[model samples]
Structures are given as C-alpha cells and as structure tokens.
Target: VQPSTFITHVAVLTQPSDGTAGRPLPRQPVVAAMDAGGNVMTTYTQPVSVKLNRGDLDSVGMVGTRTVTFRAGVGTFLDLRIDRAGCCLHLVFEVAFGLFRGFSEGFC
Candidate 1:
C-alpha cells in the first residue's frame, strides 16, 4: 500500500478592539482538523496571544501569522511571525509524496 499524503488548511479570526491604552491583550484561539476520504484523522487547536502597548505604535501595527505542519503518524511543527501590513508569511509542508505551500496575510 502507498503512504498517505498530508494536507493543510488555514483560517483567520479577527477581533475588533477599541485601541485603548494599557488595556488587556486579546486572545484568539484557532482550531483545525483534517479528514482523509471519509475518515477523521487529525485535529488540533492553537492559542494565539496578542499584546498591544500604549506607547508602541509600530509594534501595535504588527500582526501575528503562524504556520503549522503535520506529518502522518507523527507530530506537527509550527512557525510563527509578527509582520506588518502588505507583508506575507509563507509556509511549506512536506509529505511523503510532495510538498504543499501556503501563505497568510498580515493585514488586519
């Protein structure tokens, strides 16, 4: 029998804030799952923490982007970055057969 191939999917969730100073940071948790043919194979959840400082405008403008890769019968690897608008984050996932690539936006 041939080895199973890996696939990846990404989703973005945004929460609007008042942009107030000295306020508590926001928490955005994301969950992802994959199914092969008709069988549920894998599931995972990622918790994202974002903090905005009062005096740091440049840092506040930066958005968080993360990439996750899962291997068959193995664990997953994650790559994270904080980027400003107009920039993009790239992710590459390697499988038994080939490679899959994906990108996420920095725009809020």
Candidate 2:
C-alpha cells in the first residue's frame, strides 16, 4: 500500500534534550506517523531513521540505533547521542522510504 495514502507526515512526539558529549540524551526522541488532521496513524508501521540536522565539521557523528522500525506507528529511539560537543543541534527524523519527515528541537 502507498504510505502517502495513510500518513501525511511524521512528527516528533518526544523531543531530544541537551546532554553531555558522547552521552545519550536524557530524553530520547520519539517519532510517530500522523494523518493530515494531526492525529496519529496507528496502523502505519514502518522504519524511521534519524540523523543530526547539522553539527561541527569535525564531529564523530550520531551514535546508537539511528534507525528503528515503528511499533503501532511510533518509533522510539532509546539511545541516541552525538559524539562531539555542540550546542543548538537538531535531529531530523525521516521515514526509511524517504517520504515523511520531522525535526526535533535544538539541543546540545
């Protein structure tokens, strides 16, 4: 089935919080599929992947399970962390198929 027919986009339900370099954010990010009306599309289950929106040029990049298959339309990133020190960083979450996408708030 075509995903666009079911989910309009994805949203960051739980935003990542600032944390020490190389340590996982105390509040992990959680993404979910959403319909056009801003409701969770519980039936849409697919893989969701995350990456740093931007960071220091010399940073080691994001660590941990960067991609996860959704359960009941929700993707929970349990251990996401940046390897280098930075401020006001944002994480971008996108569907594995490269369709829907979402962004987390700034963090360090």
lDDT tens digits by residue: candidate 1, 36-65:
442223433322222333233444343334
Which structure among the candidates has the greatest lDDT?
Answer: 2
Candidate 2 Cα errors over 4 Å, as ranges:
1-5, 55-60
The local distance difference test score of each candidate is 0.30, 0.83
Residue 73 in model 1: lDDT: 26
- Compared with the true structure, what per-residue lDDT tens digits does model 2 show for residues 1-108? 334447878899998988888898899999998887777877877889998875534464789999998888899999988888888788888885667789888877
Which candidate wins on TM-score? 2
- Model 2 TM-score on a 0 to 1 scale: 0.88
Q: What's the true lDDT of residue 106 in model 1?
A: 27
